[model samples]
Target: MGADRVGGVRRPVRAVAYAASGVLLLAGCASMPDSGDLRDVESTPRQDSQLRVFAMPPREDAPPAEIVQGFLEALTSDDPQYATARQYLTGTASGHWRPEQSTTVLAGGPDIQVDRTTGHDSGDDYAFTLTGTKVARVDAQQSYTPMVGGYSQPVHLTRDKKSGQWRIDVLPQGVVMGQSDFQRNYTSVNKYYFASDTWANSVTSATAVADPVFVRRRVDAMTQVVRSLLSGPTRWLESAVSSSFPAGTALRRGVASLAPDDQNRLTVPLNGKASGVGREKCREMATQLLFTLQNLTPTVDTVTLQRTDGGTLCSLKEDQTETVATRGSVKQPDYLYFVDDKRRLVRIADGGTAAVAEPVPGALGEGVQKLSAAAVSWDEHTAAGVGYDGKSLFVGSLVAGGALDAPVLVSQGKAEGDRLTAPSWDARGDLWVADRDPARPRLVLLEQGEGEPLDVRVPGLKGRVDAVRVAADGVRIALVVKAENGSKSLLIGRIERDEKAGDRPVVSVLELRSAAPELEDVTAMSWAGDSRLVVAGREEGGVQTMRYVQVDGSTPEGPPPAALTGVQSIAATEDEQLPLVAYSSEDGIVQLPSGAQWQKVTKDGLAPVYPG
Candidate 1:
């Protein structure tokens, strides 16, 4: 047996997992007797305090896990030089292990956590061993970031008998982490992933799918990501999963099946205890996959949709693919239309499909499949994610500009299989899109009568345009572009003043650099105001937040995505301070000010039409 097996036997040893089922509650298994006696106690101690501090030849009373965590936090602490490896060690980690080569190293955030800590002794020598869990976000995965498992080795230090203080005892030549992590630490984002499952259950209560087996598969897939080992392999697997199961593998497999919403033992507990137990053994490690963004060409096609009411939503005669033909009937997994409650199609995309699922054991009803056949058209080329209209309904691509039969222009040119995320419009009737057909993915003004874009050019931009935001007055356009070497730049230009760069509006902010330890969030830019640029993202929530950074270098902290979740259908409010008004894809519209509270507009009995 290995030391891991022996160590697990004497103390609380968690199951070595790389994954489980629906409502999969993650639990640790211990080799220690009466492992059931353990509870999440307040006295469990902050793992950091257990560090074995280093002194003189280097040694102190502490656990290596805590020490290593501390070192990781400190090394990445921000010095401009610390942007790369050699710079960090020269300024931080260089005191010990010095690397002879100059290199550029990439690091993801908050993946490793010391789950259970203990001390190991070998005769005259002693060390602190930390058995923890870690997950990594690498480019290798099927999705954005696939969760996996990891292990940290024992760190060294001598017991300090004289002074009660635990000082730095020893470091392994050099540590693997930096200083910033220590300065800012919070695992709240990690906590929220599981919580999202609960929220998903609640929100989707009315609309239920009856498949259980397929649900189990998805749940297991998530377990694989969550319990995956932290490494490059896991990253590759995430991309694969995200590509293969764009509908969210975890959401599909975990909830409806293992812990079906049905009134059985699974739903009875609600807390997921039953669900977690049943799926523990079903943990699935990530399956490796390799893909890249290849399909950037827009293939246009026109198809008529059959709304649930059996009414002709529209002739559907539109799309750049052809002159606009109409399909008499709609089919499954073709197009997904995000419609308002009143059935106004706001956003629509093709190519992506829903996950396959199986009915739960004894959960199938005598009534049979009650769900209506989705009438929207989708295929396997584009994934147009809809934007939620916080006030009235969700903006779907199918109904933008009140034209169900509007010409569908498929801006095709994205990595094959990569979910080139597109925006769902708000109640404002605008679809934010990036297309290469115009030779610029930069912001283009899309309107009912506008034959072509008015040539909205951002001031002094130098590369492929990733995103564009328009102001309330339609004057400002904010864009983000990735410079070589993973550096992000924020560019804000006057759009209304000069939609076409012919007349350059006062270039407010040319370039605002990021101080983030990880540049993942600011890689693409979105417009928050006519002049103020919002640097943020979705998916990786905890690491990024909504903040106001202007072209003039003045900034203030802003609301989190969760907080702004209430403010949908965001449109520039025009007021410098009151920057945006969010239209609800559901009920009412929300007005957003720079520091103002969100306002609603539902007095006028405006009904929403959900996009099919």
Candidate 2:
């Protein structure tokens, strides 16, 4: 026999022996004594990585406050089905309550106080108020949105007429827990969907956009991700991206468990809605599954789709996925481009050992037209540069004899600092730039980097646009906006295009949300991965630092990159394996390679950037 402590109670582990077989079976068991002096057991906190927590059921004749506390603690336990949590509710409430409806994350533990206004001191009825500061919310769709303000919900308990016991009769629809517990239980995962506007002759050529959502980390994560993918893109991205799965598609009835086989092959069983699709469409569906699962479970290298009748609809291998849909802006960049001391656009191959910088092949590189900043297209065949005056924008080819086109776009701001910002290119080959003219601030987009620039309507903009960077998928864009108080912040917005408007579609940026709400000043930022960005900013009354923030406004798990001083601009690629490039007033152009310290690339270079 051995003893172990759980929930601050000592329980014995016994070995039972079968006389006939002469075999010993070790088992750990714990039970509450039916008739004993009751004592409170402190709920174990999930602060340690290796600790497993087991929840206790409702005690006999527990007080209303104790009952509420027990239920709340049980909500944070690792129980897969939350069976122990349901034990604290009444029979009717247990049947009607839906814990999976949603989750409310508070800044800390909720405060439980008896509601005096109810005045139900009759011993048969009681009411309590659960209050806390709102932090965030995870909806049924697994979407996590950061929120602010107060949270006050009422919980009612009634005495059982026969059992003479107290049970919760009225409560909120979903569970509520502290922010620490929420972080411990849930994780973010990206679901892949093809860009609706990028459909070409070859399905593999379409671009894949990442829609991030949160799910329970220890629960049926694989199944949850698959269901989320089948449900289609979230509401914010529905207009911009398309899923290969057909409408009303779902998992086959009675199929609950999903896992990969020994050979790293995942077989997904779908309903009849997917049975009618042809081989090409089915392969596209499989491609989405392959990429979506690979993010969560890297071991899954192949995906095979099955119809309702258990017949194979289609199968796609990992190597074939790229042909179906390209991951966001993952093409390797040939050179790191920046502006040099002479105002000419120059490049260094892979931040080379010799640190030699050479001028690019274009009019802007010839030093005839000095440039303040520049952006290279993903294909590396074209480049856009903002003039030294910050009022004119020029586009030229990378070919040796390529000529510089006249200023395609110009700003009217009186001051140079208020004029056009450096341009950015999307994977679709379109160019985006923000005109910071205070009198006429607007976002401009060019179709294939030419023709008349379209004014992108931003419905809820409350500040002046200072800088802009568009993600490769073309469905999202990042901006640095200056407020009236002379502070700058980072924001992420969704790009929606109305193709039915006319020959040229109407473009709009919707739902601009803070990407770095904690930072009071955001100097520079760039896309570092599918849903992550490397941000350079500082909090109020704090020193400058660089960190990674998700589009949903949540910080990543690991520690931020090593601090860099005076980062005027920064650059990163969707491929995280590549080194990070940045321009600092203190150190000039520097690159941080994997497992190494920052090394100077050139003292004359500025505005370092990789291809979008």
Candidate 3:
């Protein structure tokens, strides 16, 4: 046998020595055998190259156990509308079943144990229990939340008198499948909304925030995503974001499909609730739709929102999208700043090839005060730096002759290791930093980089916050927390603000959850996109590596970035087009440009960062 090359991989090929016999068999392959009783030959059920799954219906007079097993297999298959799965259920049960309500993912396939006490031979009714370890869940809003614990459910069946066939009369709500099956059936998508806090300040530049959710990959994905978006943000994000669609807004009744036209324009038909919005507000709605859909289907060049009456309410093109809501990707950074060997702030052109680094403007760059770490404002107009001793935090302008202001915030931690972290700026111009004082550790927020720092309350935090980075959307914050055992973990929390009549608004971080549960030590992390982060960490008894993880606790497609050694600090921007910069002990500061290997930017630089 000779070897064959498939998709660049070589594999052994079996050879048939009977050349004449093989030729005859191939020629007569279409002919069927004669003089034999005809019977249906079922093809093997399997998934094809396109990832489409096929399932067969239950055989006639199948046992109760087989019926339950067949139904569970059908749930994992990509049967559009899940028509075959309903065949295993009774008439009433099928009508009431709502598979789209939610999905329960188990660690592995469920274990079915027949209840012996039910006495299978005594009557037509049969009972069985399904048990497995719980993994996570995807709610109706398509939000995925990681969970831990056991799962147990009961299923009851009865034989129909007319056909004498067993069918399920009682079943669990929604669908339950193993973790591997869930990953194959669903894909993550980001829904867009406007930041409520940014809009509340009457700011002209509106920032678009991403609300990530999961949707079926092969089952009318376009329509499903549009409907999810119209349903408003998820429960966890409802307080921090606002939707442009009016209350009670939804897709027009009887609308079953949505797609783009030849010119790549998508026209969405909404119910009467959205028909009366003003022109300005309608444009805002279209902008949200445009950004959300573009992420799913990049070919969609424009979006025209239509009212129930089929009249155009508003239309927005790809180029005009930024005018309504600004995204981090739309803003390009000018320079990549880092701390040099002398503990001074310096920067190089963001995309330049030269290795030369120049001192930044202002006193911090003039070597007036040595710095250990620094964060640049999103606007690139101001910079915040932590002093070498890590006891003081300084803010200054990035212009010539700009005086270094006195420490706007200071830490009283006796040890240098237990001090302030590098500062981060949100889209609203608010600064965020964590004070690691053992006596009084707290997360603080400074409004517009001035005024007294407010103690941001974290309701469920159990460990000390070692680092902090606020998303550009200004509503989500990522923290690296160190537990009492000295192990570090990455968590994503929601930032909520409550405004008062005459006093500053109250801020609190709520609903904290693990973003990297598998990693035992997270050394550095940065917001790489709207709802994605680039993390550098390692598992227990493993070496360090860098990977991308979704804020929802799901791993994104593709392998992790090229591995680097001794990474002390890592930096990335919301705009993924820019190269990634990291400070490594072996290579100093290096940049990984798109499609290229790591290149040294400087010999003795650390704490590399892009604006925000």
Tens digit per residue, CA lDDT, model 2, 211-265? 9988887677899999999998888778888998999999999998899999999
- Residue lDDT tens for model 1, 385-447: 222221111112222132122223334444321111233221123334444332335444333
Sort by TM-score, best first: 2, 3, 1
Q: What's the CA RMSD for each of the models?
A: 24.4, 6.2, 8.2
- Model 3, which residues run further than 4 Å from truth? 1-49, 351-353, 540-543
Steric collisions counted per model = 122, 2, 0
Better of 1 and 3 by lDDT: 3
Candidate 3 local lDDT, 218-320, one digit each (tens):
7878898999999999998898789999988999998999999999999899999998999889989988888888888989989988888899998889898
How big is the positional error of residue 510 in model 2, measured in Å on the Cα after superposition? 1.5
